[model samples]
Target chain A: MTDRPENDHWLVRPTTIRLLWWVFCIVLALTVIAQFGFSVKGYFGVDGWIGFGAVFGFFACLVMVLVAKGLGLILKRGERYYDDGDSDV
Target chain B: MSEILSPALILFAAALLIGPARGHWRTAILLIAPLVTLWAVWQVPDGVIGTLSFLEYQIEPLEGSPLRRLFATIFALMAFGGGFYAFRHARWYELATAYAYAAGAIGVSFAGDFITLFVYWELMALFSTVVVWCGGTPAARSAGIRYAIMHLLGGVILMVGIVGVALQTGSVDIQPMLATDFSTWMVLIGILFNAAAPPISSWLADAYPESSPTGSVFISAFTTKAAVFALILIFPGEPVLIGVGLYMVMYGIIYALLENDVRRILAYSIVNQVGFMVCAVGIGTELALNGAAAHAFAHIIYKALLIMSAGVVIIRTGENKCTNLGGLFRTMPLTAVCGIVGALAISGFPLTSGFTTKTMISQAAATEGLVAVYFLLAAASAGVFLHAGIKFPWFVFFQRDSGLRPRDAPWNMAAAMVFFATLCILIGVFPEALYRFLPYPVTYQAYVAGKVIFYLQLLLFSGLAFFLLLPLMRRTRTISLDTDWLWRVVLLRIANAVSTVLLALGTKFATLASGLLGSLRSLSERYFGQLASEESGRRGVFARDWPIGVTALWIAVLLTAYVFIYYI
Candidate 1:
């Protein structure tokens, strides 16, 4: 990995990253609030609850990442695992 | 007997002429054939335009349905884009064969019967193998061979199924059928194999990333989507497909999340995106079918754009792994932006093509009152955002600067990407443009307050999860295992064992035969020819001590004959 210099692009600056986090939180909160402005119609009984999309989306991604990590424990191998003569068809 | 010429024949003509034509003439053929095919795709009305009597069965060679026209139109458009992207740098043979491959896709689009479909399907298998070989490396050669074998296997199964169906039904017309009997089930499995469904999907990841930069863009567009087109026509509402589609969806996401190679990640996502289409086909409602068809049309454009951008990155940086690339947007800004547009479109961001089409599948599940499928699909949407939408751009463009600044994509490549990117946005903004082409009438509204808010929250939260688990998602110099292990490793070991046993069994028989024929072999050798080592006095045919190389040469000749007969 390349080291970040003191004076780099503004987008990657420490202060900017912090500010971006705040903005992300605000926007996320607002999406949940935006649910009240419009009725988030749900075909299922529970999906209609306020902020359900946000909750489901978060946990869904979290589960997927964890599941992938678990799979990697068994399946991941060195990049050249298929490079040897025995592996070649 | 047809009023309009089949557009596929026009592409086939171009494929034939591309090799012999010189510079300007070649350019004209490349640019004009797709335009002519595009025109013919529309000109042929919604019916069988041509037919022929093959072995007493009347077969439709050129047919047009709304679904067929949509697939053919995108295929022609893809040919135009891929040809433009590749014409400047790709080899002449690559261009010729890719056009033939596109012709195969267009032919399948218009195929009205099982025989016509099988013929075009084999054409795709034939030329696409050549395209994969055009990757021009040892890895490419190996992968291409494996790719050829896998597709040949698929082709045989499909041929067997087609023959079985013809015998059973005494008709060969394309129509909807569930996998009830043996023949239809075989047909379903055959098409699913091409769709990159599991137990065999590793071929896409195995061979596609090994292709030449521009070669992959074309390769990525046609084969699987054509399979989806077949599914939409022949297997719509196959309830079995729902379970199969769900498995494909999760499998793509899990595997993509573990991938470190940039191209492999995108290739896995192709499987993911096609999962949505396959599932929608299973839903089999008009709205659901429309979603599947529209998603396929939009998918070809955006997926090609994504691959084109990845191709540019591979060429510019001379890198394929995410671990070796980052901050390329600093120099290759246009390529970066185009890549980001493709990522967003694929993630179904509002105002992108994916959103307009993909949402309908979820809506279909909800409308069907399938509670579990609906929620799983919604979660899969978020997972798609995690793996493809955020993960792709973050690693390739926004991670630590690799400090290797390369020039942006050339004018033609940029033009191709820009063209596809424009189509992505245009389709998203005015989905009615794509909706009119669906096999079923579409009454769905893509943009509304409720839908946008829901998708936004879902996507944004998924983005949050991605960053929080960023360490887990770190790029690694590794590959993850999949079902291909059965053939690549397990089956190879088995073959070696079987060969060893056979060799042991043959030794005794060989000794007896040599003793019997020793005198006659020596006499014939004297009359026919002299051995290279005549002074050694080892002169009998079976008794002679043959050089290892001569025996190897004979084996090679036998294998060559076997391969030739396989194709014939």
Candidate 2:
């Protein structure tokens, strides 16, 4: 905090962001549990499992991010990759 | 009026006026032409309204149907919005070609036969390439070429299919058909190419990001969605589109996730959004078709909004990468808010257009018992939130402060964005109005409690994951390779290698030919050298003054030898 630059927006401050993160985490957990508590119909029966949407979404996104990471290793190139005078398109 | 011109023709006519006109007159035409087209589009009744004799066949140039009108309406509306966005900033030629491009899309929408559709399709290809060239950069020049080549190839394939179908079926009428032959499959492949379907899908990402900011907006809304319209018309429920579309969806997400260029990310997600529409077309249920149409309508608005937002950034700061942008919200608050609205709409957030339109496609899948398809679509939905919905705004406007603040969009551009943003929310809130334009009757409800809760849980968790994974998701000054590598790199490399070898062989052949010529010249010299020397030395047989008696003696000896041989 001592060396931090001036940030007029409270949302971007370290302490405020930390608090928002906690709130977001709690709300997320509650929403997931609410699905089980409400006994909502789901496309698949597994969707009815407690916190299923949460688990699925989180894991799916996690896997997607990881896959993207792995892809970046092979696919990512310098910004000038296309400007190499040959691969213009 | 008894005489009704084609809505597309009206727009095309307007395009011609853009070139010669100047200043306020041009702007007036730019803004009014779409309204005129929209008016014309709605005037006709549901049937073939106009026809022309072409090549001994009666071609329906204008037809009215629920689907055709729906597509035409949206294309016209897109022309209006895109025109509004581009009028002040874009060069006259770009605006002209864009209007013509929109006209082509509108024409395709109303086309009742393959011949008409093919002509309009090529018209769009030609004009949109010109629009890409309006970017006026070396990159834009080359990208336009690649874009043109890919589209021309697709056009050729489609023409072949159309001819084959016409030969066998004896009509060019557009209708839903099975991919049961070489002809139909070729047709499918051709349409898929325009839809940015795989192996060739990279063209969309490769070329679009190179376009001018407003140019990209116009490009995004037309070509791929027109392909969707074509699919709905001719290849609905074709089953294979489901697989092709899912690949587009996932590929879009992964590539966007890895993309550094902000506009390219948006471009990738265009493929992703189009994937939803394509998937619904594959589903082929009444609700699904409605969903596809509705989604296309909705997607045009939101995607244009997003692209416009990115365009504003590009215009304001002259930067297109997330790594080079941040804290834009401070100065460009209006742009940021509109961008977030667009992002939410695209992510299917409740009370947004995307939520209302996209869920219908998923519901269609569930109804059809496409369990695998449904779940994968569900996962891709969250991925959408991850890649575009959140990733776009957070990186460009909210990430680490790049210490750059630029002014917001110009008034006209902002108004254009606001126009679309309002529509995104309005349609989400009152979807029945949009539904009324749908080809199929609307029976699906979007606000069911169970579905709402499920999507909330899913999208929210996806958002949560994005935050937690933000460290890994840092934007860099890099580009992600795509299928374009096949042609842009691999194929080009191969071509280069072949050219180099050919050059080597060419030099070798030239050397050998020259060497052989030299040797032949020397051989001739050998035979003629003595003759020349004899002539010069005055010792040549013909040149020498020999005694008559000596010559006669030699002739007699030669005659004696000949007589002896004859006697023997």
Candidate 3:
């Protein structure tokens, strides 16, 4: 590893990261809250529910990650899983 | 000469020349060949302009249409772009094979008959396997072999379907097909295999990342997208495709989330992105077809750009895994920027080409009152943002520094990337340029305020989720098994066991039979005379062991015949 000081880049500075996270949250909230500003419509009942895009997007990703982790338990193997002669079968 | 020349032949000629040409001559062919093909692509008039006799069938070598031209143009452009990126680094043979592969894609694009189409399809499968082998590793060789098997199997199924249809209908012409019959279903499954649909989807993620850095860039553009072109032409409105496409979209997302290799992550995303197009083809309306074609057009530019950026990293640092890559944005600013652009474009972020094109598919589904499909597609879109949009860039470029400061891309590669990156944004801002080339009338607008806001909310919150769950996505040096385990692991084990049992049985039988025959031969020799001695029989040349490749080939031939007979 390079012996560069830990927080050399401004983007990685702790304060800057923390401030950016706050700004990011505000932008996220505004996207959801801005829905009320517009007349939101949906072809389906569940989609038109308040904050549906936010809720759906969040939970959808969360579910995918969980599903992936669950599947990985069975499917994931060492990088050399198929390399050994015995395992090649 | 015929009034119309096949652009495929131009690329093929270049492929032939690439092997012999050296230095400036090689560079000139690489740059000039695809441009010539591109010009030839535009000059051909629309429809099946001409046909020639192939046995009893009149095979169309070239046909021109808005859609065909669109795919061909991009393929030629990719040949140009990929050539420009690779000429300085990749070996001559890799370039030659990649050009032939591109020819296969262009051939499929303009093929008006099943005969011509199958020829091109097999051409692609053959050449792309060589491209995969260009990785020059044992892993690449194995993966290439497996990839070849899967695609060739797909080709056989497609050919059977085509022959069945021809026998039934008395025509070789390519036309819209439904999966109502056994024949058409085979065709659908065949195309779906290449589209990286379930069960067989693993071949793509299996083979692509195994290829050399530049080879992967070329590998990404064709194959599946050409499958998309086939799906667009042949199986549009096949209802089963909607379910299959949705499954692929979700599968790509989930697997990509668990992936450590940056190129593998991108490979899965190809499935995810193509899923959108496949589903759009299934939707099978004017808007949906246009959406599929336009997205394909935009996708090649951006997707190639994305892999080119990854190739730059692989070329410079020789590390493709997320665990080994980080803080690359420090030195390789251009590559980082281009990668970010591709990631955002792929996620359908507002004002990107994906935004302009992908939304049309969702709009098509919603307009058709496919509420379940619409919602599912939207969720999958969010998932795309998580795994590909955020996960790939964050891990490879912006995570904790791995203390690797690789040099930026070479000028040729950088120029190629800048060229594509400009297109990604330009298409996003002005969808009309792409829309004008669609197969049908283009009336859809991609930039309405409400839709943009909905997508922004959708994609951004997914980003929020990505950061929140970043810990769970920690890269590990492992592989996630897909349905390919059925053959690579399960069936292989069964074959091994069966072969073991058979070998033992054969040995026992040989010993018993030889002993029994020896006694009978002693009796006969006592009575009259033995014709030949057992010692000489055992020492003969015919007693030599058969090669495993020969056994495998015989087995393949038997299985293929069995499938053909059964399907018939």
lDDT of each candidate versus the true structure: 0.90, 0.90, 0.90
True contacts kept of each: 0.83, 0.71, 0.71
Model 1 lDDT tens row, B1-568: 4553568999999999999999999989998999999998988788887778898787998888899999999999999999999998899899999999999999999999999999899899889989999999999999999999988888888888888889998889898999898888889988988898877889998999998998999899999999999999999999988887888889989999999999999999999999999999999899889999899989999999989999999988899899999888878889989998999899999999999999999999999998888998899999999988988888888887788788999999999999999999999999999998888888899998888999999999999999999988887888988899888888888999999999988997898889879966767776554566666554445665779999999999999999999999
> Lowest summed-lDDT stretch of 10 residues in model 1 chain B?
B532-541
Task: Please give the lDDT score at residue B459 for candidate 1.
Answer: 94
Model 2 segments more than 4 A misplaced: A1-7, A36-38, A85-89, B1-4, B522-568
Please state the error at residue B430 of candidate 3 in Å: 0.7
Comparing chain B with the reference, what is the TM-score for each candidate? 0.90, 0.94, 0.92
Runs of candidate 1 with Cα error greater than 4 angstroms are A1-6, A85-89, B2-4, B507-568
Model 2 gets an lDDT of 0.90
Angstrom error of the Cα, residue B354, model 3: value is 0.7
Can you tell me which runs of candidate 3 are displaced by over 4 Å? A1-7, A45-50, A85-89, B524-568
List model 3 lDDT by residue over B166-272, tens digit each: 88888899999899998888888888878988878999999999999999999999999999999999988888889888988998998898888989999999999
The residue-by-residue lDDT of candidate 1 on A1-89, one tens digit each, is 23574477677777888999999999999999999989788888688889999999999999999999998988988787778734311
Give each model a TM-score. 0.90, 0.93, 0.92
Q: What is the lDDT for B398 in model 3?
A: 91
